[model samples]
Target: MVSSSPQTLILSRILTQNEAQPEAEAVLVEAGRVVAVGRREDMQAQFPKADTLDHRDLILTPGLCDAHIHLVAYGFSLTQLQLYGARSVAEIAARVGQRAANTPIGTWIQGGGFLMSELGLNDYPTAEMLDSVSLHHPVLLYSRDLHLAWANSLALRLAGVNENTPDPLSGRIVRPLGTLLENAAELVARAVPAPSGAQTLAAARAGANDLAARGYVSAHTMAYEGPEAPRALQTLAAQGELPLRIWACLPHQRLPEAAELLKTNSELFEFGGLKFFADGALGSRTAWLHPPGFADGSGTGIALDSPELIAALGREALELGLVPVTHAIGDRANTEVLNVYDGLRALARQKGLRLRVEHAQHLRPGDIPRFAGLTVSAQPIHLQGDAAMIGALLPQHQRTSYAFKSFKAAGALLAFGSDAPVARPDVRASFAAAVTRVADNGVRLAPNEALSVEETLWAFTRGPALAAGWTDEGMIQAGARAAFTLWDQVGHQARALVF
Candidate 1:
């Protein structure tokens, strides 16, 4: 537990984000709440008995908040065989082969984060390539976007998938034994052994602590994880072991169970939203789009949740006091989700809840304005790797992809995040991506869509706070929570400071 005694923090400067007092030299904190913000001498005189740790070289700001992440999944990813930067099929095989050599035969080897484009593959990979590396183990590696997975023959056999097996609803099994797209990935994934409850709790603790150590005070954990994920987080919070605050979402399939657990008021580990996927991701050639889809001849991507289902579930979610947070990656997906939100706007407003759309990666010009008054939870860091893909796959939608500036100008609240496990939750990388719009290939992707550093900071802090209805956070004021991020400078290195 944090110390409840009064303390005074003397800093070089505080970027309060509080319009009333935009900057301060020091802050007085008591029992995990800000008591005062003033000059160093004034605070020193006012709190004579208070303890002080002076950091005169650093800049302080409101504690950073990751608006969307899979907290437990990130924790597990930390321990998984990393393939995020594997440059070629050979490099990936080396890592898989190495892991296989150490593990006993027949064990499942799971890891991900390889981009199809990065692997220099013109077509989907085959299980035979993986078989060359791990003949005995059931190997399953996911695409960087998490929308696609590549499984070896053993893994495919274990899942009972063959050419005869028809594609699952809203998902596809790329033939000749290898890749799974969208919901189809679940076929092989379900065959993997589930993590034990203790493992889940440890992952929860690890992820929360990891983020907290990186200067985050809270996160909006988007659904896609199992029920045990949130249960573990709640368990941690109950025992005062959770370092960061969590705003969790339940999968749309679990809405009924969640509705039964809903309370009139929010709590520490709040189940505040219902998650839905309108389409798949761009990398997998599965993001639902309009006419003239991918330049590579993959048709307009797969649509996961139908508009009719979203409308019905959204209404039910709002009535039960839960926010409807949908994932819309492609332009058509965004258009469809917007249409559903239009109908539920009145009901959502009546419940004093804001509608949220995750990703919003690619948007049609006509539908861009529709995001106004809605929470646009986006990960700018994704632009680093997606720029080249966007240029190649959807050149027509390039201008609107990762449109951070346009969203804010459209009056939408932009909540920045890393979408960790998909991308590392590195704030510096997020800031760089938003401000520079520079891709990994040294190419700038729609530079006009880039945001100023100040604007990006707001998206990371104040915008997320508003999205989660966290009034006591994302600011440095007398009545606000005494949680802060001490930065070397505004967008430089940072660490959390929870009083």
Candidate 2:
């Protein structure tokens, strides 16, 4: 016999999604992998001395995963002065002044979670208002998307930006208020001292722990910060302190260094995915769009990396056996990325790497089929608040806003997430938004596009696993990772159960 004694776990309902629907089956596990799965009697007789967890009333499914999230940034965001609910510019200034008063002079003060549309100011905020709060302290408040940044006059001075300062390529400094958009934000952010190593580690831990508490067993962390963020996660993994399984990406800017590191540390964490940005976010009105972009006439949003650049990088990444994930929210952005991906489909298939598009939030109905064989990493929670902005700003694209059902029906891999630091990664909220299709004002945006409970569950589990290329997880069957989630009800609360 392979072994005299084997470990067994029997649940009242084991949701093996491999079939037409979730089926109640018995799952046998040993040595951190599933040994067999069939009936309760069959498994019990096979492992007489094995301990069994009696979860007869709970629904057991694969552990949930977040497809797109910023782990370290979210962790530090948890500890900062939260301004997520500030209603007005005055309210935001008051809060910043209060935080500045307590901190020592010359120390950097950071806070985020403000929406440009909600601030009451039609245009971007200037540095003078922040200066009025505290000229001695350097203030940097990022818009919820991290694309737009509001800085104080003192911070601007330190960054060496002035009235005559020309805009950097793919970035702009909004006149009147010293706000930096996209790459422009880096000019000032780069000059600031980096967070201490210990601070970075603590932030990573905090972020990962918070996700675990919310029942997420793994996450595909998108690279948004410096290399140090991923380094902190590696340290946690080596120390056995990593709470959630992490698959991280590196920005195209650092691909050279990352490619060299892969020579020795390939298995430490898979290094075969490159992240690219096709455009900025909608909240900042920087999303590249087709003609007559925004109803407010903000001009057809800004484009970041061009299609040629993405295609060139896509080829480079493919040569290294890496997947290419581009961020495209607007209709034009999506069309361009799809074109670039079409050119590389053969190469991607040869490399066995699946390309991904983050935030396929708005799309032209005609292009829905383009997503077939690709991953759509999306955050449904954004639709709840963004519905109103869509109507007011991009009225033309409002009908297709956050088209979740359309993507799924088109054979695309739909992996859902919260886009934390922008919205709460609350599983309850995400489930509700996906299934209900209701906006903040109780108006249903695309009610016909609502997903079923089972479909939503797959997105939270198997879809993300497939997107991240982790076949060992996200399923409940023989030889799968012994990680699962127990739900009180199909669409209700959840808790992780790792063997």
Off by over 4 Å in 1: 1-4, 263-267
Which one is best on TM-score? 1
Best by lDDT: 1
- lDDT tens readout by residue for model 2, 159-226: 99888889999999889857999999998998788899999999999999899888888888888778
Residue 419 of model 2 has an lDDT of: 82
Clash count, candidate 2: 1
Whole-model Cα lDDT per candidate? 0.90, 0.84
TM agreement with the true structure for every prediction? 0.98, 0.95
Local error of candidate 2 at 414, Å?
Answer: 0.8
Ten residues in a row with the worst lDDT in model 1? 259-268
- State candidate 1's TM-score: 0.98
Candidate 1: lDDT of 302? Answer: 97
